[model samples]
Target: SADYQKILKDGGFVISMSGKGNCYDNAMVETVFKTLKAEIIWRTIFLSRLEAEIAIGRYIDGFYNPVRRHSALGYRSPCDFEAAA
Candidate 1:
């Protein structure tokens, strides 16, 4: 934990806490960012900002929502999870 804090400090990332009662503030947003960096940003080299934007849009519409496997949903995509429900 100390090493993580040191890395954040070196990176100039200021860690902030949620309000006292709102326990889930930014949790989902952080998870999405982590997944996006791992699955797309780290793997791709785009020629332009517009190209990267389009690719991210496509990834969200074409894969992440309807097709990407969610382990918490028994490894099913959102579409399949909804269908089963």
Candidate 2:
């Protein structure tokens, strides 16, 4: 299909594993998803989809991007790591 072919071409320079069922292949990403679900989704029951969207947006952009410390990035937030670089 054109979509599949185009995706392959577009991702020529990217390092991504093809297919699924390989948990160890994307460990860091899986960990982040798990943490988000545990901290945000499981902790609160949103009355509306829009409310949940807004809350997640704020959590990631306002809190996670600037203040959340990541072990992979030398215990610094993504914003701090980027600023240092």
> Which prediction has the highest TM-score against the true structure?
2
Backbone clashes under 3 angstroms, per model:
0, 0
lDDT of 2 by residue, 7-77 (tens): 88898855456676878888888988897898898999999999999998888999888999999999999
Clashing pairs in 1: none
What's the lDDT for residue 84 in model 2?
100
The CA lDDT at 73 in model 1 is 83
Worst 10 residues of 2 by lDDT: 13-22
Error of 1 at 30 (Å): 1.1
TM-score (C-alpha, index-matched) for candidate 2: 0.81
| Candidate 1 Cα RMSD (Å) | 10.8
Sequence-dependent TM-score of model 1: 0.63
Q: Best candidate per lDDT, number?
A: 1
Q: What are the models' TM-scores?
A: 0.63, 0.81
- Model 2 CA deviation exceeding 4 Å by range: 8-15
The per-model lDDT (C-alpha) reads: 0.90, 0.88
